[model samples]
Target: MQWAYLLGLVAAATAGHVSIPFSRQDYSASAALVKRQASKDITLEALNNLTGGGYYSEFSIGTPPQKVSFLLDTGSSDTWVNSVDADICNNQQLQATLGTCLTTFNQSNSSTYQLVSSDGFDIKYLDNTEISGDYFNDTVHLGSVSIKNQQLGLALQSVRPTGIMGLGLSANVATREKYKTIVDNLVDQGFIDRAAFSLYLNDLESDSGTVLFGAIDQKKFIGNLSVLPLRPRQLATRSHHSMSGYWALTC
Candidate 1:
């Protein structure tokens, strides 16, 4: 389910104005709080000409961690990869065009794979293509942080083998058993302080961007940081009660 809330930051202001550099904001903190503060910067590979036309990030799954490229998206919440058993995933042309089709998840190779449910996993994309499979809990590593028992879907039926890494809020997370998304685990495990991240698209032609977790890079922005609230999305008189996902700002 997707829910929209104003994306506002509560930071201490000096001289009745929020500080620029973002990191320069002065706020009283406990000694223990200062000790537990941590952050991570994840470099996203720009995929301008890819089928998705966005960014991709590397993620390792399982105990030894099998490396895979995930489509970085904020619109969905289910972090899923293609399984070897997918029926419609054997398109040779798609494999050549999109490198993702050649990749497949081998559960037998993973020692940390824990089956959550054999049923109740399904996802429908914007193209009206659906992928369904079993849900599993395994260890996932994003940068240096090792998240144990992270819930992810293993697609058994998919048109394309490309996997997506959803960076949306918990309200939009897709899972029947109710598990924590990667961002939630990051904050829960103290890898990041806040639930906010910044994505900077450096080159439009390259379709490249940089994603910073927990903190924003001051060098990315040219001027002052204009923080805007995330207003609730209301299309027509009736709100989309079931349409819960995506970072949509009311224009």
Candidate 2:
């Protein structure tokens, strides 16, 4: 059976020769998938994760590029980071690596950082963990390209410290209006011709994978990719509307 390739990205400027790295370490299905359709370019990049089958990508936030690691989750739509002043990143949370929110985003040093909102940013996980923080707009560097005034959550209180780089569709974004998700901003800023991407994961031994944005890596996969329409009706019915945040398709 043929599988559909997953899509997501970090917004930036320019188009050709754009690529980034995704880092993580876990044992899961590790295979590459490429997409081509209606004449649009597909970009590719690597991901990184330490354990528990999670994947992360590298992006430079703020003016001088304070490099940060974020879990590339297409299932959700709000991208957030833990602030250094947050009390949630305690010693106990640091010890337990599983579901532990690591890394504190220092917003003060960012020359381009701007506070957009002071309230109503919250997210609750299945395990009863949650986070609440203010919203801010800043520059995000994807490889050498730069995307200006992108919205991101600056967490002040969170059950976990690890931040999330949400790639969900803009229509389904959980945050307030006047801003765009990572994928949406990419299309609006001309970083990619279309708002689509592909995800690839390596085997347990290799612990490596790639996520393509506006261009695909032909060397990663063989055979033509079959495009699957997003089946919201079927998926919503199956999920009972609870898990409808993802780009669900009835393939």
RMSD of each: 14.3, 10.0
lDDT of 1 by residue, 65-154 (tens): 887667666667888888867654676654444344646677778999999988667877543446788899899877666778888888
Which candidate has the highest lDDT of all?
Answer: 2
| Per-prediction TM-score | 0.72, 0.76
Off by over 4 Å in 2: 1-4, 7-17, 26-52, 90-102, 176-178, 202-204, 232-239, 242-245
Number of backbone collisions per candidate: 5, 24
In angstroms, give how far residue 30 of model 1 lies from its true place.
58
Write down the TM-score for model 1.
0.72
The total number of steric clashes, by the backbone 3 Å criterion, in model 1 comes to 5
